[model samples]
Target: MTSNIGSPAETTQPVGISPYLSKRIFTLQFTSTPRGARLARRLVAVRLDEWGVPYGTEAHETTVLVAAELAANAVRHGHVPGRDFHLSLRVTAELARIEVSDTRAERVPPRPGRLPEPELAEGGRGLLLVERLAERWGWCPRLGAPGKTVWAECALT
Candidate 1:
């Protein structure tokens, strides 16, 4: 099967690709639409369940919140006509990382800022929630393309 760029080369790369690298990375791409965002959140819950994170448990709760916010931003702020967003959950020995990438290269996600009043705002609270939940969170411009990926990580218990 043909593969996209930056995907590991089928033939070979080199030695010393982390001996303890993770094997349970789950990734999927969905259309850049509101429905897609909703699906992303549902999928995260399902996957976390598969990995034994019980519903309403701390890991499950934290991961779901992070996934939901990132996917919503991908749909709301980073969507481009005819493009899709990618959602990835990578769990290593020490952390769980959730990433959402979408095709709106010109727009960059702002750094998390102060929270607004709960009754006075209809928006601008997503990043605040992310900052409070994640151990660390940030974004990176997709190389060789016109999109950005927002990612968050939390410790593994």
Candidate 2:
């Protein structure tokens, strides 16, 4: 039930989740470019549709916005030429977890409530939006990789 949503044709098949859990997982790798960021967001919407979360619902909309902001940050701040960013989404009955990993471990976003003042010329409010919309959000170093994954969890209810 994937929606067109301008999803790029480059997406791969969704990975299967662990057998012990009642969860669905969707994972994809994208070029570290603005176009890739947009594709990530659009595919998120499509994936939500496949997961029974209709478009325009709060859950679907929140997850899409989080995907977009995190992907945008990956392209704008964590991009490594010739390297790609990764997006993984895990949806369970209770919540949806969104993880966006980029190859710049040193460029982690500032902790929530610690962001610098908002400026008209400088754009840094993405995390703030994530903070407000996500049930909880944070980041960690990408295991076995020289990078970090910023993650956000949103409640389905």
Candidate 3:
């Protein structure tokens, strides 16, 4: 449940500053569980609101949904016993970026442009939803860690 909020330089910005004129970053580590996933989703909404996106705006909802899907996937697929997942959110003048890093490196998601075949099963559609909602999404090796980071970016304007 630990969280850090700041700018790229790790300095806190004034609350009333225009979101478009400055960059904001929020990073948190959560246990790889369903409850953790839910918390991540909720916190994302709260953070976006504080950044001036507001609760009911399309940008806010889309970013929160992207966070939920990424967090759930980290718990369901990339989880390792005793390891926690990480969520990093960055909002700029034109886009909101969401990154979820997990400790299981071998379970990388499908590539950015390729969509998995739709299955009739009850699961496995999370990435499809991400694809439709995000301007772009992808995964890469977790920097300085033994895992991968899956990320998505949603347009704010």
Candidate 4:
């Protein structure tokens, strides 16, 4: 519930938050750089471990990869000088949601299953990975803000 996503040290939950609900959500903002993307992936993995999902498990592995791809795309295609990208992970009894938001709202990724035919020689396969790993994925313009958010969901049950 707290909007403190600017750095790793600022992960305090809001006042009076319930412990059960607090563990279900995690959010952070990072510089729109490769290091930031890497941090996004690492942090999410650590959080999953704390939540009992643990690394190396199917749920943890898929969610981490999905977070990495989204974060990398945010840095590579959605970077805007001085603007940072945001990451949010939410888990429930039956599902997990990963969301990455960046300042470049105009640079949304290709829709699911709409990647260019035959693939490219040098790159352009990140979303394809998300499509294969996530139960579903999509993007939307940041509500009441500048930029967009790309989100992927996975079933835990």
Worst 10 residues of 4 by lDDT: 1-10
Q: Which window of 10 residues has the lowest lDDT sum in candidate 2?
A: 1-10
Give residue 119's error in model 1 in angstroms: 8.8
Off by over 4 Å in 3: 4-19, 120-122
Instruction: Please write out the lDDT profile of model 1 over residues 1-157, one tens digit for every residue.
Output: 0112234432122266652453356778887888988888998888677666668888888889889999998888898888899888876556779988888988886665544555765776787788889999988988667789899997767
TM-score quality measure for candidate 1: 0.78
lDDT of 2 by residue, 54-130 (tens): 99898889889988999999999999998899988887777889998989988888776676666642677898888
The best-first sequence of candidates by TM-score reads 3, 4, 2, 1
Instruction: For model 3, state the Cα shift of residue 4 in Å.
Output: 4.5
TM-scores for all predictions: 0.78, 0.83, 0.89, 0.83
Reference-based TM-score, model 4: 0.83
Global lDDT scores for all candidate models? 0.77, 0.82, 0.88, 0.83
Best by lDDT: 3
Error of 4 at 151 (Å): 0.2
Q: Candidate 3, residue 155: CA error in Å?
A: 0.7
Q: Show the lowest summed lDDT stretch of 10 residues, model 3.
A: 5-14
Alpha-carbon runs more than 4 Å astray in model 1 = 1-21, 112-122
Candidate 1 lDDT (Cα, 0 to 1) = 0.77
